[model samples]
Target chain A: MSEQAGYVPVVGAVAEPQPAPEKSYRFSEQAIQELEEILTHYPDKKSAILPALWIAQREYDGYLPPQAIQEVADRLERPFVEVEGVATFYTMYNLRKRGRHHLEVCTCLTCAVMGAYEVVHHLEKRLGVKVGQTTSDGEFTLSEVECLNYCGAATVVQVGDKYFGNITKENVDELIETLRNSNEFTPADLANAIVRLHIPERTAKK
Target chain B: MAETLVLLKHRDVPGIENIDIYEQHGGYAGLKKALAMERDAVINEIKTSGLRGRGGAGFPAWIKWSGIPKDTKKPHYVLCNADEGEPGTFKDRELMLKLPHMVIEGMIIAAYATQSAKGYIYIRGEFVESARSIRRAIDQAYKKGYLGKSICGKEGFDFDLYIHMGAGSYECGEESALMSSLMGERGQPRLKFPHAPLPIHEGVWQSPTLINNVETYAAASQILAHGGAWYATMGTENSKGTKIISVSGHVKKPGNYEVELGYPVLDMIELAGGVTGGKLKAVIPGGSSVPIIPAELCKDFKLDYDAHQVVQYSMRTMRLPVVGSGGFMVFNDKTDIVVLMRRTAEFYTHESCGKCTPCREGTRWIFKILSRITTGGGLPGDIDLLVNICDQIDGRSYCGLGDAAAWPIMGAIKHFRHEFEYWIEHKRSPVGEDCLPPAPEPLNPLLTLTPV
Candidate 1:
């Protein structure tokens, strides 16, 4: 069953009653192009709003500002509330300021067995921030999640889609150091070379 | 493209999830094929193919579809269960987002098989992108003569599909609750089994209806085109066709693993880099509602639906029977099994809907006591109290969710008494320290991407 493009006019895909604000996320043409490429996957551009929001959140320090939300809304031709609803629905998506770096500690089974409680407690003590709270220096936001699905590596964290697998308190300091000196690194360097990224989403290994 | 199963077969074919690419890949062939067949042949093929519901129950698809008698002569309706409220489950969302047309096409095929024209996609509210995609895809089908009016060039056959966003209730994942929500009612679990009164024979708007999971509908398209035997060959005996297992929790590589039905859970673990240092303690093979069996025990556990049932039903001496929600929640050695039970108990307590008192207030009492005990605020008799509370909630609610909610606490206490005692006595989870890695280095500022 082949679907023809531009068949039914989407309520927001083409135009909306009110316009959105101009984008000012310090996003480069290259990043915007990358996002544009992703949006092309759908017949209606509005379908890309979630991934667009994810990209925007990453660019804006884990939270999407009203303008950031509007930018994605406008890009997808969807109502601003529609985009906002999505940004707020997922616990993972941040719409407010977190830390300079986001550390999501998975406390599910494998890592829990490996003393993930210690990792969580240590991070809480070390960073002096409770889960969901950012460090005073704004360098880190420590959060506990149900599972990151990498129990094999237990004690995992995603500092922006990059998986740091099989973590421990000993490696916590090094991970923090890496974040502090992130200026010298590229994500290609830190994403647990073990688990590949969500590129093309769900491209699982055989 | 009208409809294409992109995520299911996207890698094998380009433009599979993409509208333009899907169109180029000869995507809507199934719909065209479906329209050409007499709806009876379509139904019979699904019947013979041995397609099972992708939803946890794994019921026979054709039998469920055929429940509605054609001779009754009532209006036929079709529903797509895209509510996808299962935790640790994002496969439906991913598939819908990637290939909206595929689901649309699948819905069309299922509608034809069940002899229903009007359909609704009841999607979870959290799936914003999926909703948008399905909505857009339906609009695309309508524009292309794929969704509305007549099918391809067929007569006396027309289909209409609508996407209704959910109100953020996990309980709505149940088909009956989903029906209630679609009818615009608050999603409170019904204690009584609303007898499967042949929905296809008589359903929504009081017509015969066929309701299928998004994946099942997609598979219907495949079976309609490739034939029953071809479709049956891909899966295991008793349970034919592949299954999309959402491997979450503690796996190194967490995501959807689409495999032939009989693949072992161990294979899925290795697929996830051998469970992050191989310290997997226990796993909730289905979902949190499913009992947490030791990971070591699950090594030989077959991922097939029937095999899992056998192992969990007969082998595992559970107090309550398992419900079929394919939510694989992994627990590592570091997890405070007892505390985890407390959290789950609390969720069931808070979400019980209270239609039945035994479940309504009973769940809450257990959760409160379990929480206090886990946090080191328990009285001496709390463990027995917790067990008693579980007993009260089990089989005492209006819906299976009550028993489903109580299973884990009762089972965990039965299996891991020491962990619970440790938490009660020490006021801490035996899970020790959380071993999660520290935050990674921020994106290089010079690299032009700022940290969020």
Candidate 2:
């Protein structure tokens, strides 16, 4: 994740000319309605960019592809570059596709002293992939994240919307096994949960 | 001193997240009390409570509440900073998870006092479960006439609350950066006061805005329910009331403990079941941002905002530690100060918003030097170089993130200079071969294996 530092969008770089792909829209009817409802929560349509990107992430299968950025830009009446910049600034909006479950291990100060690296190594060995790589079977994507702020349960691992705490090198296998048998789309579920939080129950019922 | 239970009084009760359970336990009484009185009286209650901001920096809460304009020329807004990104701090997570109504009730009271018709709680994206609890509480509050038009049968008083979730960015925790994020821009900060108007004057689409931490709002509700003078009876002279300290690392029973402000530091450690695994080496009294204090010096301080005064006597005191956001982390004998500082540097480096040069370049340089020292590539003048870089970034950045990045490194070098000198002299940790945080391994073996 440190590799994402000092990020500056490339401007005016020359490249071989290629035909632009035909633009397509992928947001479902419910997603459009949810985005409209979220817009009402804010004073303007541009304030809905973050939640709109979440709707896009769920519609595009857990990551923000180029078309997803374009769709969000078109919906919010903002420029593509403006939407792209906002999307990349945040860490949770994935630009690339992830596996079935995104396993983010906390490796900050308290977690490091509590042996978070050993848990990372154990997961790396079991998953047969390094940090930031998805397994060949697309079952899991492992990454070392910053603190989840649940340091009381140091060495916490966040799988989608849930945080699994008190994790150690020995007990991580059980979490992986549990994730293996589940059929939920963890990343999309995370995005959906965040989107639902923005809509009030009364508004949703309407 | 024993743990005080004010905000966490009914934390252990089952179904307290539900509105009925919360009201049964004397919740919403604060809102009812606030609604009956004049708006200025509500603000006066908070002023008398002697409560300071719990999100850190200990600013008086009443000043911000009273700063909102009385005449409603534009729509006034109230915000709750639920983006808890401090490393060892999870008190807000538990407060929202268990006592959502406390936070909502406080926000409602703030809205009434500030004459704000609409409010938004900007929660972090990672805390979906906590946000769901708040969402349920808000829905229930509406059903009971605690929200929406003419809240709680108070004629012509209308307030609406909404939750706005943030994408991942630690810079957004800063108040101005939070406002920028709330306005749907990049999560970078704007220029602060003196050069620019304060947020109270112009914020959130150029309207008067009042923003407080989750704990601060929760504490506000308590101060209004039980009179301010009654709540001000606890703690030291300068700091009053109880603070929830999130105790983590090397402690036996690591969790959130609410204690009076002036409680002794050592007593707080014992309250969390003492240091585990080995004798105590040091304690990061607050979150990762504050200065680290050696175990010997820990006895002199108390858990209050003024605890930083002790650091004035230290030899190389460029920074001081406060009861900041209450992230009390304890370290045992096996921990390595140099490695710990390296991880701390890496965090600030990754989270720097890159809006300022001193922070953007300096944090990366600090991390690079520390990474080289830890990976067996130390130079003779590297310690001085680290100090120079920290000095450059200390007060030079746009936000406190830069200052936060510099404090712990300087503090570790001030107290444990020998550990850094040992690493420079002999390219290994002075603690042992088996330090708590071992040296870094190449993240991807394939990249290292490939021919250059």
- Give lDDT: candidate 2, residue B184: 83
Tens digit per residue, CA lDDT, model 2, B176-273: 99999998888998888887888898988889999899999999999989999988998888899999999999999999999999888899899999
DockQ of 1: 0.04
Worst 10 residues of 1 chain B by lDDT: B442-451
**Interface RMSD over true interface Cα atoms for each candidate:** 10.8, 4.4
lDDT of 1 by residue, A1-206 (tens): 78987788667666556565666655556447656655443334654554566566555544677887877777667787877866654454555676667777765444455567678778878888766677788778776654444443556776754668768888888888878887522221221110111122222233
Instruction: Report the backbone clash tally of model 1.
Output: 61
**Segments of candidate 1 deviating more than 4 angstroms:** A1-206, B1-7, B11-14, B71-74, B191-202, B308-323, B379-381, B435-452
Off by over 4 Å in 2: A1-21, B309-319, B437-452
Task: For residues B21-122, write the lDDT of model 1, one tens digit per residue.
Answer: 777765788778877878787778898789888876788998877776665377676888887755455567767877778778888887776667567777
How far in Å is the alpha carbon of A5 misplaced in model 1?
Answer: 72
lDDT for each residue of candidate 2 in A105-171, tens digit (9 for 90 to 100): 9998899999898898788889889778899999999887877999999989999999999999989
Clash counts per candidate, in order, are 61, 0
